[model samples]
Target: MSRSRPGNGHRGLDRVVSRRRLLTGGAAATAALAVSGGVLGADLLSGASRPASRRLVESQPAAETAAPRQRTVPTPAPTSAPTPDPRYPDGPFVPGPDTRLWGVFEPGAPSNIAALAGVERAVGNPQAIHWYQSWSGPGSELDPVRLNNVREYGALPMISWEPAHAGWGTDQPPYALARLAAGDHDDYARSWARGIRDHGGPVVIRFAHEMNHGHFAWAAGVNGNTPEQYVAAWRHVRQIFLDEGAQNASFSWSPNIAYDGTTPFDQLYPGDEHVDWIGLSGFNGGSDLPWGGWLEFGPMFLPSYEVLVGYGKPMMITEVACTENGGDKAAWIRRAFTDALPNVMPRFQVVCWFNENVLVDWRVQSSPSSADAFVETAGTWRQRTP
Candidate 1:
């Protein structure tokens, strides 16, 4: 049965909408994960609906309009202020230099805990487990069981919380950035804020990430969204979380690599006070698609890194992956983990891998050589502490 809208007490009906895999093969059908009050977390993992398949989308570099800014480096920690959370002594979810961390995004996670076994087998347990949730009703419902499962697994939970429903690209209606800013979704927002606040554990909420890119509804210049609306919507939702006392939930305002045709990061940023971490979604398509060519990890992310670093906050690579079609994936992984992350981008406290076979096989284990490269680098990482 269809349910009432938020504020009417009944959450919307749990239903799957029709859509295809984005960015590849025209469009393939996929189901969003469904949650209900009666289901156990394990059952949700194993029995809940899963996407039938996924596609690959590469970050194509374009002619940047403006000159690149000078890159910024990490500075000394602040001397005194609010008592820091032990999990993130420096800032909200910010790992210290001695505690560099990496995370993974398997297609099946939060629900299907076993889906991470392959990753664990290759590189040991990740410091964080990444997942997604849409603003749609059932499949996107915030459940404590899901959060606890990740915590119990000895990893922090990072949620890519999109404001639009699954498969709904740039034209989400009630979820328009302005509508959100105007407080049309307060009931739903309040519910999630309270849920995470009450759970009382460290959680990373990457809200409407890659807003500088046009793939999603929240992105400016698409779906009638303006940069102002985007910032307003972000600040509005963040304030609601604060009002609910959701101190444990930290907001990561992520944007795409400021490639050609992407919006400027400055225009879209909600400001330092509104954001906890500066995040970026970058990938090396590596000749996987018709328009893609192999680009090294350094060049692929350096432009955006320089821009985001100036924000003076801890940074994270919210989404990153490389396809093995054209260049050496193993070599890329070794350089990224060993040289680039440790030496070049010391301000980046966390790196999350997009480990799925979506458009092209992006899994680190796509080849034996690539898997081994990751294992070697991963072992050297100093896992973050509480």
Candidate 2:
């Protein structure tokens, strides 16, 4: 998802006023602290206690010097076994025997099912193929041709259902969460659900993904969309799918890695009953833009992973990539597969790369080294088999 300057253009008059008050007051400070604790709790948990030397220094008076110079004593390592990774208390959520690989191919190019074949050719065969479609557009309807194509390739189809017109970067989006919650778009949602039911195969539906980002009109705090309205809208759509007997439709609730502290993601959650998978969008921009920096996978995602693991739902990195700029993209990709995914984030059931060249050169083949790194790293990880 694209980033934009924060605004309340889609908010109600009352909401805008309240938000302004919060921004100007102590409530904002409190919320910021709470967000910090939630996201960075894992790292904080380990180093929560101050060092003994610091504690001793603070306890001593400033006027009085220490009677004797305290000798530095090295602490011995623990003889006990190391604690297990808390991210998976009940063991990792392995859908099959291995992690699922998926992607959105050439997002800036034309929306064509045929383009996916090229993506598979570039990267190896993915366990799932992700594609996007707006509620109303040239490719609005759930195309059977696309679904079948993905199925024939022995991969599940993951659809990102944009609840607006196909026009990107438009100031005014056609659909709003408030209207959707009011049952205005029930027919459209139902029709799409019915199409999936008729397809007679499993489909992962990621609706209004990255809703925490203000760039999207459907995002909460935008377009008159409060957190409650977003949940209502989500349940409304999910219930319609259930009514249409789209039992094969697996719902994923995705939020961008909460780098922007505006939206509280916990409030936007529609509950475990409404969602099957918890999805996150974690990308490394690699110093291309002002917000961009050479961030490793752990720092970029570990905090968000800490928060999402508490949901107790299977997690998927629905969108992730590192730009080939100002750093070794190959090494970054290698670390993602070897260190982050397999070790730090073993609980994540699937990890999908955002294979697009939209904002930065995010494509795996942006450089020959990056391509080789991806292919080599991916080969070491076990992929889901159909």
Best by TM-score, which number?
Answer: 1
What would the per-residue lDDT of candidate 1 be over residues 1-386, giving only the tens digit for each residue? 11123211121212101011111111111111111011112211221232211100111222234665675976656777555332221112433335456788876675777888898787667767787777885566787777777755656678878787665556887789999999998899999999887765567898887776576788898889999999899999998988887766778887766655667777887776788777766667666554336778877677667656665576778777778988899999999877777677767777888787655787888888999998887556433221
- Whole-model Cα lDDT per candidate? 0.65, 0.60
TM-score for each of the candidates: 0.76, 0.72
Predicted candidate 2 versus true structure: per-residue lDDT over 8-116, tens digit per residue: 0011222212211111100000001000001111211122243211110011111233486565996667879566432211111124333345445344222354565
lDDT of 1 at 345: 74
Worst 10 residues of 2 by lDDT: 28-37
How many pairs collide in each candidate, listed in order? 5, 2
